[model samples]
Target: MELAKEIAKGAEEEGAEVRIKRVRETLPQELQSRIPLDKVEDIPEVTLEDMKWADGFAIGSPTRYGNIAGALKTFLDTTAVLWKDNLLYGKPVTFFTEASTIHGGHETTILTMSTYAYHFGMVIVPVGYGIPELFQTTTGGGPYGATHLGSKEELDEMERKIARFQGKRIAEVAKKLKS
Candidate 1:
């Protein structure tokens, strides 16, 4: 979602600011798809810094075994200090995932990620609209967060609309919460 980040940055031009963070894991194949496998050591420090620096966060991953990827889980595990200090209490957070197939358990991935946010005492924001794409999109975008259904098919216009809306909506809600 590198392209989506630019869109999200633009959505913040009205005064809401957002930043993107990447938490790399140790798996060679997966790390290659995301960051260099050699970069895994940087994940925890970067994650902690980002969590402390931002008022809100949006986490994304490719689901593994119907759950958040191991790398993300490892990063979250390093937040014990934040949890102990209640650093994340009441902050707003959302999650997104990419799945390999159509029924690749994206919703479950969202749920799994939500559990992490809950542990950190962050508020989970669900997609508010009842758009047909929530039920019909072949690619991604849902009330669960922004997602990408990985397959040969490209994202349709409706899915793109929903993703942009999701980013805007989350940023707006985060702004309200901060206020």
Candidate 2:
């Protein structure tokens, strides 16, 4: 959630309007009750309409077996109507993710998520070694997208910077496309 906020901050800095929404939980109620969700309870649930409303998007998810979390995948799977209408076509989209370890499929999760963007006809905006932080960080950020090591309580400075850069870059590209 913190990573998403940082990305949103970067977008806002780039003069883009941003909305941060969380995918609805897909876990069974019994299982959901065991995890603490209060920190994100107030964030509005993402909807297909929200996808249409945005000029660009930065999607963040936790990696699950080298894939996007089920909640986010489920949300993306519901976008057939939007896909049919080409509502997201030509828009710029980027991704961010978290994994349990340094080798915990962060890049793969981003790659897997990019398939959705391709099918939606959205342009993928990758980090792509454009920033020095990518070279310096031992923790998260990478060419695929901004990421965080899930073992950390908070993002290290480099991770935060990389995420912010991603947000700013996506917003800049979106603005150019809009104009």
Q: What are the models' TM-scores?
A: 0.81, 0.97
Worst 10 residues of 2 by lDDT: 30-39
TM-score of 1: 0.81
Give the number of the best model, judged by TM-score.
2
Off by over 4 Å in 2: none
Write one digit per residue (lDDT tens) for candidate 2, span 1-179: 88899999999999999999999999898888865578799999998889889999999898888998889889998999999998999999999999889998998999999999999889999989988988898776789889999889888899889999999999999999999
lDDT of each residue in 1-179, candidate 1, tens digit only: 53256336534754667665577555677446764345333333356777888877777777786898787888888889999999999898767777877678888988998887888779887765545677777666667876776664565666666666666666777788898
Error of 2 at 54 (Å): 0.3
